[model samples]
Target: MRKLLICILSAVLLFFQARAQENIQLKSGDLIFQNLDCGPLCDAINAVTQGYQGNKFSHMGMVLLRNDSVLIIEASGKNVHLTPLKTFLSKSAHPHYVGRLKPAYQKLIPTALAFSMAQMGVLYDDQYLYNNGKYYCSELIYDAFKAANKNKPFFKLFPMTYKEPGSGAYFPVWKVYFEHLNMEVPEGKPGCNPGGISLSDKIDILGQYK
Candidate 1:
């Protein structure tokens, strides 16, 4: 009886362990969104843009499993690059969430990933302009999927606004940013942002992690 009870307990433990592992396993092409609290710059972005599901995520990346390791393809800082998934999550100020394309769109994953891989080392778009030979985070996703869809974009680009919600004036930080760049703010320019893409109905929320 003692041996039987021990075996039953071990089985229960193994079952729970497997469940935990399944919960965290990420598939290739999953989208990870996070709010990175890098400093005042990130705060400025969160202040201006609204996010979906009550999350004010300021950054995003696409997941890829290469050679048994999970990696994130993101356009950040100076260029588009690959980052380890663990390290990517560590940079988030809020818990990150994973989103996946709906079942009907699953067939596009390989093509999208291939497009993203081809964009490796592309310059990051600090100006956040469309067709500028540089890409911001969400723009990378937009372009990748667009290519996958043979130039028919899966996501739509809306005219960007840098103003605080309900206020007609631009955010003070945006003014500063443009001043630093010695260029006018591209207000009303067609572009994509992480917050907007997070709201897309084509994706299903998979999980959240801190």
Candidate 2:
């Protein structure tokens, strides 16, 4: 009876351990979003945009698991590059969340990842414009899926707004950014943002991690 009870207890521990691992396991092509709390720029982004699942993500990346290691393909200050998942999560101020394309759209994963890999080393788009040689965080995802869909974009682009949520005036941070670039804020321009894509019907909220 003693031996039998010990075996049962061991089985219970193993079952819970497996369950915990499964919850943290991330599949390739999963989207991870975070609020980095980097500075005023991050603050401005979260203020003007919306998020799904009650999150306020200001940045995002695509998951890529290779040779038993997990990496994220993201466009950051250094441009589009692959970052280890552990390093990626460490940069977030709050717990980051994952989003996955619905099963019906899962078939596009390979093509999208391939396209994203091909874009490694591309410059980060500080101007946040479309069709430029550079790419911002969500723009990389949008373009990759668009390429995968043969230019028939799976995600939709909404006219961008830099104005405060209810106020007609543009965010002060935006004004300074564009002025430094010596260009006008591309208001009403067709583009994609992380917050907007998080609410996409094509994706379902997977889970989050700290």
Candidate 3:
């Protein structure tokens, strides 16, 4: 009985959310950026990077417009999976931003989404390393577009930094995180983060998704 009530509640919530977002006009393959308020780790992430117009973002996901429902494809939790747009929005407390590809690059959306779909169950890359057979949020988006562009880089990658800006000292959160994993911080490793990708010239920022 409890499970049935939960299902009914979920349906009602989705119905209202759909109506609320009626005018969003989002398209498939839109790059959605979110400011995650997930404590020190997220704080460290924002401290080291800057998003479009200097906004700080800690997470990202891609939009998948399927019929009347809007979903988000992201490498989060234990695997890569699709989440309802409502669910994705609710996960972050800060405003979410959307980026749509310019007309010239719209053709790549299908291939990019197709690549993402094929990676449905890949494990999350908590280590934040490139090509280690796992997918982190931004890395999944990076590789999907790269695959769409025939394995060419559709997005740029840079050496990752885990240090506090201007201090050149490693953030304490990252220090303990890597230490717990028995690995040194992978600084200088090739990586692509949400903040960096938000500044790409290939897409035009459509402002806040809300």
Between candidates 1 and 3, which one is better according to lDDT? Answer: 3
**Count of clashes, each model:** 0, 0, 0
lDDT of each: 0.87, 0.89, 0.92
Per-residue lDDT, model 1, residue 124, is 95
User: Quick one: best lDDT, which candidate?
Assistant: 3
Give residue 196's error in model 3 in angstroms: 0.7
Cα lDDT tens digits, model 1, 1-210, are 999999999999978755654596688999998898877777777876666777788899999999989999999989999999889988865768788999999899999999999999999999989999999999999999998888898988999878777878888888999899999999999998788888898998765754
Q: Give the residue spans of candidate 2 off by over 4 A.
A: 1-22
Query: Per-residue CA lDDT of candidate 3, range 1-210, in tens?
Result: 999999999999978766654556799999999998899999999888999999998889999988889999999889999999999999887778889989998999999999999999999999999999999999999999999998999999999999988998999999999999899899999999999999999999876766
Which residue runs of candidate 3 sit more than 4 Å off their true CA positions? 1-23
105: Cα error in model 3, Å: 0.7
Q: Look at candidate 1 and tell me the lDDT of residue 130.
A: 96
Error of model 1, residue 126, in angstroms: 0.3
lDDT of 3: 0.92
